[model samples]
Target chain A: MSVEAVTAENQAPPKPRRKLRNYLLDPQFQMKYVGMVVGVTFVVASVLGAFVYDFSTSLTDSMMANELLLDEYQGSASFQQIEERARAFDRFVLISIILGVLSLVVALGLTGIVVTHKVVGPAYKMRLLLSEIGEGRLSLRGRLRRGDELQSLFVSVEEMVDRLRAEREEQIDALDRAIAKLRAGDDRDQALASLEAMRDQMARSLE
Target chain B: MSVEAVTAENQAPPKPRRKLRNYLLDPQFQMKYVGMVVGVTFVVASVLGAFVYDFSTSLTDSMMANELLLDEYQGSASFQQIEERARAFDRFVLISIILGVLSLVVALGLTGIVVTHKVVGPAYKMRLLLSEIGEGRLSLRGRLRRGDELQSLFVSVEEMVDRLRAEREEQIDALDRAIAKLRAGDDRDQALASLEAMRDQMARSLE
Candidate 1:
């Protein structure tokens, strides 16, 4: 195989397609917010729906009274027409209530997921990076996506890692000078070896 | 003064009552999420309101037609009754529309703030703590609140800080041993001073 082909094969695998669950990177955090929004919507819808139902029922009762009065006048045509309009109004109210609640739930649920994702995504990434740092892996290869929330926090973490790396590098350099200085003295090999080991350990931490 | 009185004076100030603006610790981040939620609600409400308005108008027209037919029958009492019902229906539609929109906005907007605050609060605190670490202040005195989002991430950060603190302590201990071993050697004053300075610097970082 050509060198370029071999290098391509050795590279990191392509990211997998995001599944539905992928959007909920932190379900515990995301769901709490989603529940809050959806709950509020439900309460508001219920209260308003009740008011509308009461108004609609009273209106329908009054219209029925008029229908009876017209019946006495032998106005069959007007009675049928008014009855049709009443049925249409009832139908409109029923359909509206059902459709309105459904639309609100769907719209708000999707919006909650999207909005919470912005915060959870960066936090999830940062937690992974932090655990790596805890294990002495000072090399921060991953970065938060653009437009992610917590950009400032991520930048601060990056600066912290950079500062740590620089300090380790300085320690290694100091060990190098100390080892060189002790080389000419008798039985200095033990001290030199110890310093070298420390330097190597510090250098490995940056990898 | 008694020691207890002096200690009380030296203690941190009492937390002030949270103001309206205090909830918006990170306005830029919080508002974007709030805007997305409110915008979706507005679009849904607008579409639904339009549908309701059209249905109401058509229903009103049909009722008016019925009203004129009753008028021709010389039924003044029935006419007035029908007219009053029609006016009442119109008023209900108008009030419902106005009230529905207002309630949805208020409820959703408050939920947005509270939900987003859970995420933003921890992120803001972490940024402050991370910057302190970058400046060699390894002491992490702040903590996330109960019910806050990003609790796992906050724990991971605490672990990272603890690990870093331990590593610095180890480095200082090694320096102590090195300085003690060199104390009896000929012309070891320079080496001892250098090691002591390094140890002090490492110790200070954990302060």
Candidate 2:
């Protein structure tokens, strides 16, 4: 066998990376995204609703806002008149508020689902990676979804795993040496201390 | 055994509630849900685009359209004369078109994200469930998200898993009987065969 191959065999595998979570898999981020969407949706819905209301009642005095395009505020109604208007629109206002609340709740639920998916998707990928590692399949290198916040952590994990793999190789080398000098799985209880002391010395010298 | 202890072991677990996804989680349902959102979004965007385009320009065009009100129809000059008048407000017309397209794109992107999230979230959950089962975590249950279209399939899978677990327990019970009857690992092969045969017979009977 080539000397290079022999050397390579003796070397520990690069440790797998330090463990990192997938960013998209993060429940928190997913929830935040969902919240943002819901907020935006609510704002858009409210604006659209306001516009529709304005269009429907454009001809009426009630349709127009008290603050017009002009600089001055229009105070057209007396207290009695305002009371009459309030009574007239009481039912409409109540119904409108209820409808708005219902819409908001529905939108929030939907946004929550959307966010949960984003968080869960990345999480699944992470679980898959972890399982691979647990099964001693460390050679598996796969791309996580880009822009995941957990990318840095994952990268660090991968590096740590690689380093650990290298250390494992070193440990195995030391074990092989001990086995070659003695017996495999041999009970060394009698010479345990002496053997370990000698082995440590040899390992330090080799390093 | 005390009545309470007997009840604890023998009492049946409450049937898990069926989610819409469990009730409906299927490829066909997924496609339908995605299709509905996609279709509605496309239709909404298209209609809104057209309306925004038509309404914005027509806001002023109504002046020209009302010939009797404008009184500028017959007395107006040649085609060039009308062209000149139209050109005066062409910038606003162009602006409206641009705004319409921008809004259309934004609307489409939002729709795409929402639909994608809905489709992929459950898929991720299913993936995790499969992984857990593969790793000998047979007791793991899938959590179906709300509004998932594969409810029936989820329910069916859950039932299948339960049946499988029960079958496994029966097999293990039979295996224990065989092992107990035998004295050594040397006869383990025969014991395993008998266990398998017994399991097969049980399966056939069930069928």
What part of the reference interface contacts, as a 0 to 1 fraction, does candidate 2 reproduce?
0.00
TM-score, predicted candidate 1 vs. hidden true structure: 0.79
How far in Å is the alpha carbon of A177 misplaced in model 1? 2.6
Model 1 alpha-carbon drift over 4 Å, by segment:
A1-16, A74-88, A184-207, B1-15, B75-92, B184-207
> What's the TM for model 2?
0.34
What TM-score do all the candidates reach, one by one? 0.79, 0.34
What tens digits encode model 2's per-residue C-alpha lDDT throughout A1-207?
Answer: 999898889998768553323223454545554565555545554554454344323322322222121112334455556445534544453456346534543544453554345335544555565444443443336766763323333454355345434543443444344333333324433223333443343233222
On TM-score, the leading prediction is: 1
Model 1 chain B: worst 10 consecutive residues (lDDT sum): B198-207
lDDT of 1 by residue, A36-61 (tens): 89888878877776676666656665
Q: Name the docking class for model 2.
A: incorrect
The residue pairs found clashing in candidate 1 are none
Clashes of each: 0, 33
